[model samples]
Target: MQTAQRNSLKLLQWMMAASLALPLALFAFASAMSWISTSEAADQEIQRTLDVAHEHALKVFETIDRSLAEVTEVIRGMSDADIVAREKGLHARLRVVAEALPQVKSVWVFDANGRALVNSLVSPAPDVDFSDRDYFRIPAERDIGTYIGEVLTPRPPYLGARFFSVGRRRNNEDGSFGGVIQASVLPEYFENFYAKIGREPGSFLALIRTDGAVLAHFPVIDHAVRFEPSGPLGRQIVANPLAGARTLQSPADGIERRMRYQRLAEYPIYVSAGLETAAIRSRWVSTVAQHLIFGIPATALLFGLLALAYRRTQRLEEEASRRIEAEEALRHGQRLEALGQLTGGVAHDFNNLLTVIRASVDMLRRQDLPEPRRQRYIDAISNTVNRAAKLTNQLLAFARRQTLKPEVFDASQNVRTLSEMIATLIGSRIEIAAQVPDESCLVNADAGQFETAIINMAVNARDAMDGVGRLTITVRPVNDLPSATTGPPNPHGHVAVSVIDTGVGIPPELFGRIFEPFYTTKEVGHGTGLGLSQVFGFAKQSGGEVTVTSDVGKGTTFTLYLPRVVGEHSPQSLLAEDAPSVDRANASVLIVEDNAEVGKFAADTLTQLGCTCVLVENATHALEELAVDPSRFDLVFTDVVMPGMSGIELAEEIRRQGLDLPIVLASGYSQVLSQQGSGGFELLQKPYSAEQLARLLHKAARSRRLRRDQAPAG
Candidate 1:
């Protein structure tokens, strides 16, 4: 009878548990259903905003271009000299035309020499030169139908506010490039219209040229700011859709938003509108929170009834077991529920990634897919893999304390520019003072690692100050080491970047061990103590040193001294690979890859490309193969990261042995490559395609042949 009672009690407990979970289950189901609907609604709303912005931009641009055409007719038969003779009359007419359109600030007719003959704003046009501007220069190069110029500030006679121009080129008697007729476009016209449109808080509105130049923006943007064609939104715009909407992070401000963009039908301009992602998420969360608020109390009530019933039917012996079992089941249910939510949240991003791969794969499976389409699909897969590799790199880099890639850049500018970011990092309670001279203090080191070091020190300083104190960062060139007494200074001169904080300073007794790896005074879960160690490691590796001076409860200063270099870096452009890539159809390649699978893939891919290949698992074997026959291979292609000897080290060894073979190093990421950059060898970044491999191999082999031919006779 007692056994029966226990079984009955157990059944009752299970029923109550199920009842407790019912409300939560309903909430979860409701949340899941609403998520998709909510996201679609958000996208639709943004699409509507984009349409408004696009219509406004089109109308404004159309008006400006039309007015420009009308003004151009005024000087159709007249040359610059002829226009100059009738300047006052033409100027009055131009002013009349400009006054008719609020979007157009002024109209001007410029000669081939960029001299303003007549302008709407002023007669004689203030003698301001437009020759150097794109509007004047582009038309001078060719008889462009309508040229849209970059944002520019007008000279003396006009307001200094920014304006873009729509200009048409006039042909000379010989049909040669002549002068320009420009209408200065008012950016405020777009901004004011954008303001009138109803949008969610933190929405963004922008008008941009197809070439990735910003013409105007709603919230106002820096005139010089431009987006890269490679960014997410840029890619979408380049896809040449009539209109599209998606979520992406803005390149200018780094705010993620659900954005929609529409292109002007006849023009090379695209207008974009976006609602901030955080706002959308907040709205969804509010809905979910309401469900949670209603569900939780009901769940508690069911559990309370269960607890009361269990207490009433208790046999102390079985009661303990029942409680433990019931608690465990509840905990398991909670964990499962948490897991479901996490999966639901993460699935969105992963599904998007998978969709790209899956669509590409499905296309590949087509029986009659065109070669061009096939190649595009292949490229898409490769790109998606590269994207996944980057995500993986972030995790690995965090755990592995990834190495640096150094560049020659000004340290003072980095400090000054990073001050605002640091302010965001440390909190508003902390006052930041940055001291960087106008003169550049160039250093040969990794800019990223330098930034990481600065961030670490700033974070530590923030904590030391208890989030409210003056933090000063000073960057200046120093020849002598006043603080780094323990180490010698860089004889060439050192750039001393110091982070000083008026806070609860570090105890001097701990200074020696502070730079030690995994040795942190910060409470557990706060830090792993790798920050200072990394800072110290970077300084030493760059042939410099770090020093710290602290007073207990007073303040502390951490200085990083790096070897200074004496030059500015000329900007390097990353242009796309030339068409009809170089090919070495029957060239011999030595493949050095550590992974069996990767090595097999490289060998197989090269073979398919009509290249004779030899696969080696390590640098030692590769060197042995080269030693056996020095000129057997035309190119040595190796992976960057490896056991025993790295690809970089192998390349150096091959050179040391005086082998004439050209080496192409490949990697997704590596310490040496990151620190010292390509090392003057041709580098093929990992996740490359067969075409990329073929092109690089051909270049390397061709280089080898050239070197041999150019060498003095043996």
Candidate 2:
């Protein structure tokens, strides 16, 4: 059983571990995947930002080219002479187009010699020398489609916001290089658009020319910080010119970032967007922390349950082991104790009986004994023998082996009759009261044992009251009484006879043991402790029960519940019997007993009562005498238990052979008689007087003759 329990606990512990472990394991895997996903997400975000910046740069360049084309159409087929000639009207047209664009600060028309013909801010065509500017110088050196100039704040006489210039080379009708069509682009316009993209902290965006000049930056730089052409990002850009991304340090802020760059389709311009590595890491950390917050406590709770179960299991095993040892020790002590008490109780009571018989016999040996004194001594021995017999019966009663002769009798009247004798038994100091119902409470039980039970209870009450308290005996019919053993209540009624006493009551703790034999609370000589046990056994054997209720300082009530038999009875009166007359004239007796002396004593005693006596040591010898003439002996008087073919068997054999002899079986206490029954024979209990033997023999013989005379002829 313990092993099964441990196995179950182990199974439960494993289940608990698995229940939490499975989810936490999945959560841990998910957290790792989420971290990787965050990193991938950071790279994707950077690429998308770069795309936005790339598109914005393309749109700015497209506007610049469009404005330059309109101006070129206005100057179609015209020289620097014609361009200066239409300069006023052209200046108004350039200013009208630049005013339409938020990003275009101004526009200039310069000839091949780098002399400005028309400009948007000063309409009369200011004499701005653009030959020194990169827009003009780069285009003059190499016939490029368009040249992107370095960012510059307009100096004196160049009125507008900070801007970079986009310039296109013009061709003559013969396809020779013409002057540059210059448009000033505002850097703040792209900066405002990048800021509007709403990147998180530590992120950066920029519009960069392939030549490593930053046109626009977000957050816009206060000081001019040029991009490194040979750094990590720059080297990557040089390796893969169109588009690339890498983890690199920012040249402006020196922060590590994942930076991506994309080149616009039609221009020598690249857009770069970078996200700080630390910010990406923070996102990954936040996801992992959430999983930990939920999983850690659940894991702890699983282990906590296992620890508690382990502690409880260990404690139970230790306690169970101790209990086993204690129970073994208790059982051993009880066996030895029970045997000793049984022997002591029988020996103690029998020794008193022996003392009486011994003393009386010793007195009978006196040579000068007077007749009256001899009779008294004889009576003492006789009474003591009866006492020894009664004590044996009391032992059997407690054991529930006593053969009972039951009759239906009124329980109320019985107790009332005993009420007078009870006063003499307990004493007059205690008040006696009897409460009996008008209807008789009849019960089929051994009258003698019932009376004995009542007397035992009254005696105990007297002792409890210390000889001076109220004693009440009540008898009434009851139905549906609850069983004493805690079984279902009896629907059939019972007669309840209660003996109540106003004395220091029984303590509740001692209620269970009060019915155990030789277990007494009285002083050593005052009780044999068989009284209540006799009550217990008698009630049980009679198909009834006994119960008790008590309060320590108030009183106690002992109730005996017997199955009530349906009957009406006239009130019974106690009667006394005179000395029985014995007539054993012309009687023939056959005695079968195992003991030689006891057989001889019976035969000799019957011989004095005028009976022919035959003695045998066992049933075999008695059968030998009966084989000669079965009818010669009037009665077969035998002991019930013997060595071989016991007296009951012998009597059975005689009846089988159709003998007319009557069988009279006797014993002080025979297992066969107590258990099987008295087998249709006159029973004379042993240690009997000659008069008892004589009376039984005459009765058996007379009964046989009467039966024979009553037989009809065939």
Candidate 3:
């Protein structure tokens, strides 16, 4: 009996060991599979990126080829005498072509002896000779279809900038060379294009000749212009077929990279795009790290639970189980503490706003309150409500859920308008200066968000300087986007609104966390820490980015980059068209609202606006009211979010019924409105002021009248 009992105990121990080993083996298998999957996905993404780069390179070459074809045709039907007489017209045509193509810097025709003929830059041509220029000599000597020469800075009569020329030999109609029609492209143009398209920090793009001469290297290297095919990678590139991709280490930077090259069929050059191996590896590692972070903790917890179960059966490992539980409880406590801190900060801010509102209301309720004091109390309430609204807006911005009313406007003008208000807010202790350009710097974005971002930065700067500092707000154009690890790249020619301050700057260690929500270095009760985050969100939502540069002692500068708008109607002009000319008109309005109190408030506001209001609780009731008298109500104002049918749907239904009444959709925040839009109906954001409501009503009334007048006779 004793031997049997001992055997049973040994069997139980074996069972526990096997059970633990099973999960460990499964985890290892899962990790291996995950790594393989991640590696494959990374390679696929690299290939996709390379493919896109190849397409862009091809498109650029195709454009140049077409431009060359057109130029060749222009010079075909001209003789020496005609060339001189038609020089003006030829030069004008070349100038138009060059101006139309951003890549082409100058287009000109050179004689076989390299004497300047008709050039795009100058008329009554200069006595310049390019006889020694490679662009003229190469094609004149070689029997090649088109000759592309090494990049060089040309002498006077042409811009003294580095450019690579593409030349096609002109025939004498006897199969003999007459001259070379050449088009030169500035290397800077390629550099700008490459910079805009490059995805990684260390990535590069290059235009290289088949003979291994680098024509243009984006990020501009000194030795790249005359680079030789000496290194293993270079030799491989030269020996390899016209178009393909490969992985090799760069000799210039010693960085291993994945490169894609495409040879231009029309030209003698090839374009190559490369992404560093480190970038690809970093991306893969990040994905793996995320999986491990969650997986390791989860696996450990599972093992702990299994061990606890095994101990329960043995009834001797209670102390070990208790210790594991204690550790888990500690981790839980830490999470709760973090949650409490975030909620505490938000609750504290709202409480302060509420306290001001509560106190102002309590004072206003006094039976014998004096008129002057009452007005002061009313002002205080209004200020508090505005502050609360701002706080809510900030929260929404940080959450990336704020509904932005984006418009294209001159940012410089807006900054000038706000300069005075900013000065008043920051106080006389801080000197505010605005450096706005005379020319318009148009940007498409939410003007209000832009203003808020600038004000937030200014306020932060004031605190940093202890209220004595010089704040400079400058609006300028950005030729290239800032290099950022995250966020979308700004398009070429973006508008930058910078807020620079001469005050104590941010610390390097805190730079990475400054844009984090609820992450602030300020003293408690001083800030809610969502200012920079809101700016970040606004920039991203506007299809741009926000960047900051600072030193330990020197001042900080915050730049909000927004996509540049070429030409759009200014917001002021649009507002002027929409503005009410006179007092509110006496009209009938159909109000559809689910909330009882909100419906009553709308009715009262419309009554004050000299409008007869027909209040209904739902869309069914609204349709019923409309059925009673379709022509009675001049405008229909409905809540966008309702129980039975949405405001947008109701408007669609009314349109289907051929009703000419104007519809206005109101919403605090509605997904329907966000996705499908108001469908030609005017939108009024919740909590709109009386003046705003009056203007909207007047506009709606006018729209209804215009629609009725435009209808055909029955």
User: What overall lDDT, based on C-alpha atoms, would model 1 receive against the true structure?
Assistant: 0.79
Model 2 segments more than 4 A misplaced: 1-30, 313-714
After superposition on all CA atoms, what RMSD does each candidate show versus the true structure?
Answer: 36.1, 30.3, 22.3
TM-score of 2: 0.41
Reference-based TM-score of each model: 0.43, 0.41, 0.39
User: After TM-score superposition, what is the CA distance of residue 624 in candidate 2 from its true location, in Å?
Assistant: 99
Q: For model 1, which pairs clash?
A: 404-674, 405-674
Which window of 10 residues has the lowest lDDT sum in candidate 1? 570-579
User: Local distance difference test, per candidate?
Assistant: 0.79, 0.80, 0.76
Q: Cα deviation in Å at residue 290, candidate 2?
A: 2.0
For candidate 3, give the lDDT of residue 297.
77
Q: In model 2, what lDDT does residue 425 have?
A: 96
Candidate 3 pairs with clashing backbones: none
User: Which segments of model 3 are wrong by more than 4 Å?
Assistant: 1-39, 77-82, 200-203, 218-230, 238-240, 306-714
For 284-386, candidate 2 gives per-residue lDDT tens digits of 8888888889778877887777778766875576566567779999999999999989999999899989998999999999999999999999999988988
RMSD (Cα, Å) of model 2: 30.3
Rank order by TM-score, top first? 1, 2, 3
